[model samples]
Target: MSSALVRNPGDGTNFRYYTNVIEQVVSNAETGGLATVTRSIARPDQAPPLHTHSREDESWIILSGRVRFWVGSTSLDECDVHEAEPGAFVYGPRSVPHTYQAITSTAELLIICNPGAIEGYFHEAGAADTRSDASHSLMEEYGFVIHGNPPPAPQTY
Candidate 1:
């Protein structure tokens, strides 16, 4: 049986992954492997490479600033792009290739993953001492397949 859990603002495990700040608010262990939640702050250059998850479905709720997300079931070259602002929600199902980039100076978003396994990846990869030498193995262990760089950000005239 699991007891109730509460996390106030700034009350979570925080770490820096690349240029993004990630806070794991709810762990899979606490929920008995049902779900995991995290809060992240990122800049435009902090966007992740194009990738697909083999295990969990991921969702995001935009909290502040603007972000552009590319989601597709088949390939990155053919995907739906969405520009979201505060209060926007996006979902990326398992096996779907997806990535997002902040369009404003800064963006804050809440990330949720079903079945909670991906939290392990975040915890390990976000460690300050983690080395790039093990990145491929770590990603494989976490059920992630890196495709390539995300599409270039849309140009503003």
Candidate 2:
């Protein structure tokens, strides 16, 4: 990133993951020891599955629109669901199962992965996005597990 004064405002790689578009802003390679930042552009109903990471903590900063989320250890049977508006912030520590969905027509989330690990998964998860659930191999590779699948779409999403 130091090579340029700044990344062009509209110059981020957009990866279609699940039913949403994740525009990578700051890659793990760029952050050194900092977190990787991604801009999640989502439509209503788009969401990730209940999953957990064994290493890095996840941070979500709602930039616009509304998002509904569940985060905790009790699993889906018992978990805290929350409604987040613009400027809201949510944190998921390592080992916690969490999931979230966009509740508005347009929801933008600034996602930060501390210790900068999951960024590579976003780039390399080519055909794994088809099913909401991450395969065991994929989970092992990314250090995350899908407690339950989110929904099924084309694997190549």
| TM-score of each candidate structure, all chains considered together | 0.87, 0.81
TM-score of model number 2: 0.81
Per-residue C-alpha lDDT of model 2 across residues 5-121, encoded as one tens digit per residue:
355535778776655567888788887856798887766445677889988999999988888777885366576878899999899898888987777777888888998977777
Task: Give the alpha-carbon lDDT of every model.
Answer: 0.82, 0.75
User: Residue 117 lDDT in model 2?
Assistant: 77
Which one is best on TM-score?
A: 1
Q: How far off is residue 74 in model 1, in Å?
A: 6.1
Clashing residue pairs for model 2: 130-155
The lDDT, on a scale of 0 to 1, for candidate 1 is 0.82
